[model samples]
Target: MPTQILKEQLAISIRMLERANHIDFNGHMSTRVPETDFILINSAAVSRSTITADDVIMIDLEGNVIEGNGRPPNELPLHTQIYKRRKDVQSIAHTHPRWSTMFTIANIPLRPVVMQGAVLGEIPVFPKSQSISQQEIAEDLAEKLAGHHIILLKAHGAVVTGTTIEEAFVRSVFLEENAYRQYMASQLEYAHSLEDEDIQKTKNVVWQPNNIRKIWDYHFSKL
Candidate 1:
């Protein structure tokens, strides 16, 4: 089982995503326990709107529930395979942000336009729209997402990974913001992506500890 702090953090993030409008009903988040093969994930059956620390379940890399109540999300592989492939990733969030899905559905490349979006880097789209339930499909998508921060599932949702739960939560929020801005800009004809030099410079401040905490604290304050 995860510590009380970990459970609280996961529960808070679920509420954070919900408050940001990043997820409604079919969303999930998970964190890898440090120095172990264990993971703490939110229950799929638990309503994100009313999630509590007790709703978090512990599962190993193989998806077996080690503690807590309720089942992990059906898209467990969406999280497990990635944790296996990316040693750098400590947390993951699966969300169905409207604008981010629009980019995938319309085949429009979602580029970094806002300063905070520079942290997202180049996002790839998984070829399929169906639920990522099978191990094989999850493994393939993991390979496709191995070197990226986020991947959009065609006509579905997005999977976001971060070095910390805070980063993942913020990136998920920014993904939708940047996408909506790009969409609105495209209507006029000039939706220029952030220049490479600009992206390089902006990322330095965007990922700063204080800034990240500011975002996390802001959301936590709301709830």
Candidate 2:
């Protein structure tokens, strides 16, 4: 809601994801500044676990640093272009989670297998392997992400969007958790996805703003 608070949340979410093994040295998170054209995001060079509010920097929609002393993330357009296209997305998370990335290489599709998995439904995989450092590449990624809250990079990582950073972070958590279960299920002889009727039961239950806040609070408490 406030710039100071967004910085703190970004720092906390980055640390949370880093510890959860969702993000490594390569991942980042960003949020839109209300009533402004600027976005606040974690710096590229900072260690994910030790970042502070001060390490979060402000950049224009075009990826130019407007404040703070930290260097911009090379995949900055990953956040900038999405913010430009998806006017509904207020936050984004780029996570290279192990289980999720594993699915990118295999033929299996991520599905709503677990209880909370219904929240993510079926995550799409974007067919790009290169780094999203340039304008055109990021634009393509954004196009691939149209109308979806989460999309996995071809052989790299996953991107999640939300109306708030908490939603994005929680979805990142769900993405990995769902992918982990999906992978585990694959190890068995056979597995089945939740039926459309089953998913319908939980979709509204999990996607509610209050429920998202509850999940975020649970993770934030762990942080």
Q: Identify the leading candidate in terms of lDDT.
A: 1
**Top of the candidates by TM-score:** 1
lDDT of 1 by residue, 110-166 (tens): 989888778888899998999999999999999999789999999999999999888
Residues 52-164, model 2: lDDT tens digits? 99999999998789999878899998999999999999999998989889888885778888877888855778887889999999999999899899999978999998888
Which TM-score value belongs to model 2?
A: 0.96
Off by over 4 Å in 1: none
- Pairs of residues clashing in candidate 2: none
Could you tell me the TM-score of candidate 1?
A: 0.97
Q: Each prediction's Cα lDDT score? A: 0.91, 0.88
Give RMSD to native, each candidate.
1.3, 1.2
